[model samples]
Target chain A: MSSKKIKAQMRVFQELENQLLIQADKLGVKDDYNPIKIKEMEYDALKNHLLSFYSERSNIEYEMQVLGTDKKEVLIKLEKLEIYIKRAERLLDMYKKYFGKVFKTQNEEKEKIEKFLTKSRISVSVGEN
Target chain B: MAYEAPTIAANLSQDKMFSAQKAAYQKLKEEVPKEKQNEGTQQMSSLVWETVEGKDGSKTYKVGMQDTVYLAAASSALAEDEVESLSKNNNLRFRDKTLQVLKNKMVKLAMDTFSHNFFVAELSKMGVGVITFQMGLLGISPAEIEKLMSKAREEKNIAVKNGLAQVASEKALFGIVTGAKIV
Candidate 1:
């Protein structure tokens, strides 16, 4: 086929990529109050989309390479999609990496503070006696 | 040039945040394989936020040792913007430079074709000379013009290809890290 036809196909992919990127960016925001269950569910869905896009783009590039077609245009579009997917995935990874640990620490600290308060109350009662 | 790196002050509160993150990362280090613990540590270190002290007895917090995934995500968004802008600017510059080089090459080729035609016609002053020189200039015959066009095509392909490859890698293209379990 002609470069023009390839470019037209690439433009369609680019639009899809941009839409996915915007969606990814929106979902990537980590809300402190968002329940872990909900966050995980949303994250899983976002990741599935990203993975699919990445896979599709890779397949296209591979096919182009195997067929010995002029791949520069397709590669450029694929690369952009890759970037969006990566950024989205990186955000998701950050959420996975620290979210559990952070909340765990917060809970641990809260328990410790509660324990200290209870012990201080008992001590005060004994002193009054 | 207008962009300054984010900074955080080395105050006690900021120190606590950094230390908390450090401790958290250290805890995470236990989960990684013994051989890969160092690599894990390096990766975790990138998450730390740096603190800087201001002259006015104040502090600024930068993207380092973040306390929560929220903070990291927020910072990552900012970093993404910065990186995107920088890459776009760089790509435009590189493209313009390449175009300029291509432009010069085309101009030189035109001048060479003109000179060759002019000189041959002036020297020979015959139908054969005129026909050969004109054919060479018009790229009609399989001759010197064909060689020049072939070289031009090769150079154009090399220079034009892989501009966006710098933005993303072939490795990254194939290896997308999805969370465990499709659900």
Candidate 2:
């Protein structure tokens, strides 16, 4: 691909990143309760968005390889996408643990509920028997 | 007379051997047909032809490379064509996969932002209702508690509506930027 095209594509990704950052900032300011947490969540969401693109690009690369038709331009594009994705991931990680504690808490709560429901079901089954 | 040692090996033999090798190389070059010679020259103007001796004492002409980048460029062009054809054949697959991933991400974003906000709003309403009830029980005027509850409810409702609007706007922004529908 031409350098101009690559630059244009990079600008698009940058624009997306800017939009996400602006939204995150807005969420932080608006959140009277846990502004930092909300902002971090927004950042994480954006990172995941980029990650999805990274994954899709990877799939494209694999597909291209399988077809025995690797394109230098496509590979370059994927590499560029990876760089942005990594940067986003790093930035989010630097601020917080990057989707660890939040997911852990949610999972823990879910597990607890599941265990409680299982116990209740077992007890009810025993009573019926 | 000064080389009294009588040079152990006469240089004549070495020269004769070199002459023979040169003759053999010339002969081999001649054996290569005129058409083949012209074809090699046409393909690579700066081609360096060399005679290589095998273990069996057979000589063969080998072409050597001078500085050239055309071959690399040609191979790259060929590779590009192959990739273009493959991409064209599987264009639909690629499009489907891209759209599928995009849709999935959109759905996840909706769940993460919109549903979570809605859930929080609902929980806030419930919490406010409980607080008002408790305040009423604690000898606060029932009418005052009711009024506070109504105000809190209204605020929560507006917040929920705002959250929904924000999510809708976000979706619209994504659609505008990417030129793709959220679905």
Candidate 3:
């Protein structure tokens, strides 16, 4: 993964995360809505993917503890976990803190997530494939 | 050395989502108990008062409060001064700032991995060092990348060589909030 390629993949991860945020916003139907708790589900799936990539457990475990198993608590957990993100420059692993977590959507759920994402505010570039 | 292709372990599961929240709700329900349930779960409202100045003269912003779950998601990124404002409260505002920063950081990393562009003026000066902190924050092993690079060199594939070289840039890898080119 040469530092360069890792860097490249890192960029991709950020883009994907942005796409997911917009998706979450739509799935829940309001920027501040919480009845569905879709955001944590989003982070959860993304985290699972990254954890599998390296077979690591500590950070994710740490997050689960902070976020608890509940959706409401997950929002609070987000704040605590975020402090760690501040040090990302020194801990490249920090990116995983944000990027990991597979939002846990599939079947009808996948359609829903996709719909939200599709309807999300997307800035399109023209004349380029 | 062993070679392990990147694999996604699972997809998002609705059962997982509902169960987690249900569990929390159940716990809260338990706190009420059978006899006192109705009285216990009743919403208890708290109000905070503040004075405000309107065009006429002086007015007030009630600054009412909820159970903290109701506010609109804080803007996903704020300047240092804004961060300071959030901090002035009893950490409630700070938590929002943290969440927003967390959100922005998440997007920034994915963007860097996909785009690999130097156009982001914020992190470029940071160079390859961005890889460690950004990747580490995600809990992904920066070491994994390092190992892959080492393996690539030993194998000496021209394609691999080129890819590895591109990753070594020292850009910040992410920022407080990814804005347009940081200009």
- Candidate with top lDDT is 2
Candidate 3 structure, TM-score to reference: 0.18
Q: Write the per-residue lDDT of candidate 2 for residues B12-31, one digit (tens) a residue.
A: 43234445544655565575
Which clashing pairs does model 2 show?
none
Native contacts present in each candidate (fraction): 0.02, 0.00, 0.00
Query: What are the per-residue Cα lDDT tens digits for candidate 2 across A1-129?
Result: 455665565466445544433333323322442434444445545555666767877787787888865688777877766765665555556445635766788899999999999888843345654
lDDT of each: 0.41, 0.42, 0.37
Model 2 residue runs over 4 Å out of place are A1-32, A97-129, B1-183
Candidate number that wins on TM-score, 2 or 3: 2
Q: How far in Å is the alpha carbon of B20 misplaced in model 2? A: 99
Q: Which 10 residues in a row give candidate 1 chain B its minimum summed lDDT?
A: B1-10
Docking class of predicted structure 3: incorrect
lDDT of 2 at A10: 48
Give per-residue CA lDDT, model 1, range B1-183, as digits (tens). 011111123224423444554565566556546536455455442232222222222222332221333342233223443333433443333223223333333423422321213453223223222222323222233344344444543443332223222212222322334222211
